[model samples]
Target chain A: MEYLLDGFADGLMRVLRADPQVMLAAWVTIKVGFWATILASLIGLPVGFLLAMGRFRGRGFAITLLQTSLGLPTVVIGLLAYGFLSRRGPLGFADLLFTPSAIVIGLVVLAVPLVAVFSMTSVASVDERVRETALTLGASNGLVAWTVLREARFGMMAAVLAAFGRVSSEVGIAMMLGGNIEGYTRTLTTAIALESMKGEFGFGIALGVVLLAIIFVTNLLSRYIQRS
Target chain B: MEVFFLDNVKFRFETDLVLDIERVTVSSGEVVLLTGANGSGKTTLLRVMAGLLTPEGGVIRYKGEPIIFGKPGLEHRRKVTLLAQEPYLFRGNVLLNVSYGPRARGMNISQANEEAEEAIIKTRCEGLIHRDAAKLSGGEKKRVALARALAAGAETLLLDEPISHLDEENSKLIVEIIKELAASGITLVVSTHIPEWASTLSVKNVRLAYGRVV
Candidate 1:
């Protein structure tokens, strides 16, 4: 108990002193989460809009599949990504496995379905009257889509923010694909896991605090954006 | 002279069948009235004519060639405008909403602003130029919606019960605006049942009935 107390005190002091490892982990987590989210949003947002707007023979079925995929396991995604980056897999030659890039790939995969699921509901909920109004006004399809998307932006941002939260806090994929390499693949969550395992309770507890702070900031920002 | 024709049209919504019509035609520069009790296919028929809904069975020919749907539908869309029964001002100021279409079509900022100013004047909404469109009153929102339509250069105005929720005076003003738009060579298809007001416009009338009830 005394050792645990001592570690906690040490971790607090380290945080107060601007420890390099603590800052580096936080920075890497932000970078990986941001880039992966952006890529996922670019792909997921338009695909979601198309899913909501365009009709096909099996759209209901496809939507069901997409919605189901939103609950996909992070470990499974990591494993699947691991295969692609492994020596025997398709892109094995690039030697990307167990690296930050691999971690980004995992995060992107994990974020896509999440972003799509929310954006789909957001886009679909747009009033048909607005669309009819835009159409009647001679606005093109692109313009109409833009209008609908704009109207649903608050909801869509919530979805994107949720994806960011998922990736930021997830441990399984980052540990598996990123390998938690020091000064490179190390992230807030992975560092927490690693420090906790090494019995460095103070550092892990400090990271946990930082993680909570990031989540709070993200939540506040998304809510603010939605309200505006 | 017919800008559009909807013939042998039939539309159904899931278990509720909505529209069944043999033939209808609207010539250019004519203000038309679509009226019936609520649940009549007035809105549905307008949707079909505007090419928003595909009739289960019908031919909608615009300009002699059977109108097909595509990005080209946007071209016709640019020519016709529809106003919904409710006012839903988009997020932005009045000036932004009025100029949104031109900007989307790649109009220069200056040109879009100029056109938007002209539309605000035309819709008599110049007073609300800088106000938040999303915060406007029912009558003001409708007029702003009209200004948006006007800015897009739409010549055919399709209004769905424009006065459904307006005060008596505001409703009367909207009716007067419809008459003026008709006189200015813009086609107006307004859906309403106030015969007192309907009689005042130089308009052709069309009535809607439900698929089964009537």
Candidate 2:
């Protein structure tokens, strides 16, 4: 137990060294998370608002499905993505399976439902008075929606952050779809798993610590943002 | 030059009739004070004038043509604005909050600033122009609401409980401004429980009770 504790601390110190390999992993995580978040927001937030506010035939069902998808299993998502990207599947000519692109695609798929559901919930929570006041003031449709989003801006931000957090630390999709290729598709989580299997306890422990700290900081940021 | 007409207009909220106004005419440059007990459709009538609610029956006319309740409504939206009971200020500074409508209507940034500044000065809220609109005091928010309405270049203003949080001095100042605006051909409709606001203008008093115009 003492040896294990010593090993864990030393591994954390090693991972915190900011060397090229660790830095590379960190850079990839940031890049992937940022891109996934941007794409999710662009595609999901507006659609979610429309789904909540706009009258449509299947709105209720769509909202329910999105709500249910919020708790979707990551491993099941990985399987679905793998099946679609594998040979003999849809557009298999592009050969995206086991690539970083495949990992990103899986992450985005996992994220959109969360973004959409949270955005819808947030838009629904805005005061109805805001829309009525805007209409009474002669604000156009665009302005009305604009005012709602601005008033509920914090909720939209939460949706974005929540989606980012969901995708950033997810390992199942990364491992299955990315194949955890060294120096390429290998993410922090995937690398931790691989190093642990190879009995490189220090590297695995270090990566785990970084991931935990990131999750903690993200939670703190979300709290601070919601408060302000 | 009656700017608004409610000929036997009726409005229902859920199943209850909220407004049953008959033959109410608001002539141009006239200040009409709406007085009523609480839940007497004061706000509802104000909302009808502002085009926020559709009357169950009858028609409201602006400038002799009927209001169709479209995106732009009957009034020139660029020049007609309403300040509701609790003004919904956007997430921004006072200057931006005041300038939004004008800017959206194609006013240049500098022109919007000038217009917003003029409006802020008009409402004596210039001191709060650089302050955050979302965190303003109640009276300050009320004043900012007036400035924002004025910023729309509206020749007609419908104010609901505009003076609710104001002290006597500021209310008097606001009344004077309304009178001056009336003299300059701006139509005004102010709804309040207090009666004295009617005496300040070339005004006609209308009483609403239990959703009916009396």
Candidate 3:
């Protein structure tokens, strides 16, 4: 108990002092999370819109596949990305293993389904009258779609924030793909795992606090957007 | 000159026939009233006329030219506008709602604003220009929606239950606006369940019973 208390106090102090190693890990986490979420959103939003509004063959199958992927374990993603990015694998020529890019690639795979399914729910919630209203008012098909998306903006933003939270706090992809290299590819989750195992409890606790803070801020932002 | 002509039109909601109009014609600058009971296909017919719904089997001609339902129907749709029974105001200020039609028609901001202001004044919504459209009262929403339709500069307007659910004063105000619109030579097709409301206007009455004109 005394050791835990001491570690907590030391971690609080390190957080307040802005320790460089902790800050670097937090920065890497933010960068990887942001880029992965952006790429995921860019791909997922349109796919989601199509899923919700478009009438096409096999659409139900596609949506069910996406929903099934939402429960996919992160380690599986890490393993698949590893297989593709390893030197002897199919994409081996890219030489991307153990790099931040590899971590982002793995995280993107992890986040896309989450973003897409949430976006689909958000857009589908918009009233059907919105489309008819736009069409009756002379808006082209593209403009009508834009209007519907505008109405669903807040929910879509929540989807993006959810993706950010998922990727930022995940450990498996960062561990397997980034290899938790010091300074270059280390992230908050990876650092927490390594530091705690090495008995650097203060460092691990500090990173945990940072991670919690990030998630709290994201949730607050989501609530604010929803209320707006 | 005929503005709209429908022959052998049929529409169904998953095999439950909603509209089966044998023939109907609306002339240019005419005020046509569609009166029917609930579930009598008044709204469905209005939607079909607005080009928002394609009839299952029919021929629809606008100004003597046949209207194709897909990409080719856009031009005809632009020339006609429909106001829903429960109007949906876009997420923005009243000005934005009013300006949406003109903006969608490719007018510049200033030009759209000018058209919007004109319609707003006509609809007696000048004071609500900056107010959020979603927060308006039911009557206010209907007026703003009508103003939006007016600003589109369409040749024809179709209003579904425009005065339904409003207080007597608001209903009278809408009737006055309808008269004004009719006098201005804009083609109008208005649907309502109350026959007494249509008695006040000099309009061609097209009564419907189970989707058939009676």
Candidate 4:
């Protein structure tokens, strides 16, 4: 108990002093989470809108595929990405194996289905009249869709926050694809995993605190958006 | 001259027939009243005419040209506006709701604002222009919605039960506004259950029973 308390205190000190390695890992973690979430939204929002609004055949099958993808294991995504990015693989010409970009690719695969499914549900829940009213008011079909999406923006932001939370803390993709290279691809979650395994409790605890803080701020922002 | 005509119209919901009007025609700058009891499909007919609901089978022609449902429907839809029985306001203030139509049609900000303010005055909702639309009372919301429709400046207006559930004062206000709008030469199609109030206006009447013109 005494050792644990001493280690926690030392972790707080390291976090406060902004250790270079710890800061680098934090930056990488944030970069992966942010880029993955942005890419996911870019792909997810339009797909979600079409799923909710367009009258297309096989939509149910598409929706089922998205929902199933939501539960896909992170390591499975990492392995699939690794398979393509590996030297002997089809995409080897890009030379992106075991890099931060590989981790971002893995995280994006994990986040897209999550964001798309949540956004579809959110946009679907809006009242049908909102779209009708916009249409009656001379808004084009694109403008009508824009109107509905705008009305459900709080819910969409919630989807983004959920996506960010998911990718930021997940360890499987980071460990498998990032290779946890120091000063390059090292991220907070992988660092914590390595430090704890090596019994460097103070270092692991500090990284954990940083991770928690990022999630905390993200959730706080989502709440503010929702309430507003 | 005929503004539009629906010929051989048929609309159904699942196995239930909602509308089966053989033919209906409206001229430019005319006032037409749709009156029927509950579930008589007055609302459905208005929606179909507004192009909000596509009939299972029909051809709607505007000035002797066909209005196709997929892309050409937009041209007809832009010229016709529908005000639902239940008022729905967007996320912002009353001014935003009123200005939505003009802004959506590509009007500049100053032009949209001018039209919105004029509509607020016309609807007698001047004081409510800056208030949050979502927080307004039902009657207030209805008035704001009317202002929005009027500000749109569509050639044809479809109003569903515009004065059905309001107080006498509000009903009188809406009736006067409707009369004014009709006198200004804008085509009006109003749906209401109360025949007594509708009888006061000199307009062509169409009564429906079970989705068919009677």
How far residue A153's Cα lies from its native spot in candidate 4, in Å, is 2.3
Model 1, B94: alpha-carbon shift in Å? 1.9
Docking class of 2: acceptable
Candidate 3 or 1, higher lDDT: 3
lDDT of 3 at A193: 95
Candidate 4's DockQ: 0.67
Best by TM-score: 3
DockQ of each: 0.53, 0.46, 0.77, 0.67
> Each candidate's TM vs. the true structure?
0.88, 0.94, 0.96, 0.92
Q: Per-residue lDDT for B13-100 in model 4, tens only?
A: 8889988887788899888998889888899988888888878888777667776553347787778899999967899999999999
Q: What CAPRI grade goes to candidate 3?
A: medium
lDDT at B13 for candidate 3?
92
After superposing candidate 1 on the true structure, give the runs of residues whose Cα lies further than 4 Å from its correct spot. A1-9, A57-61, A88-90, B2-9, B14-17, B22-25, B57-65, B69-72, B101-106, B208-214
Report candidate 2's fraction of native contacts.
0.38
lDDT value, residue A150 of candidate 4:
89
Please report the interface RMSD of model 2 to 1 decimal.
2.6
Question: For all the candidates, what are their Cα RMSDs to the real structure?
Answer: 3.1, 2.0, 1.5, 2.3
In the range B1-214, model 3's lDDT, one tens digit per residue, is 9989999999999988999999999999999999989999999999988888888998988899887564356787799999899989988899998999999999999999999999999999888999998789999998898899999989999999999999988898888898899999999999999868767667999999999898
Give the clashing residue pairs of candidate 1, or none.
A136-B81, A138-B77, A138-B78
Model 4 ranges with Cα > 4 A deviation: B4-8, B22-25, B57-67
lDDT of 1 by residue, B1-214 (tens): 9988877777889856688887888898888888888888888777666677777877888767576553468766666666777746677899988887677667999999999999888778889999988788888888888778778777677888888778887787777777778889988888886646878667787877673213
The DockQ value obtained for model 2 is 0.46
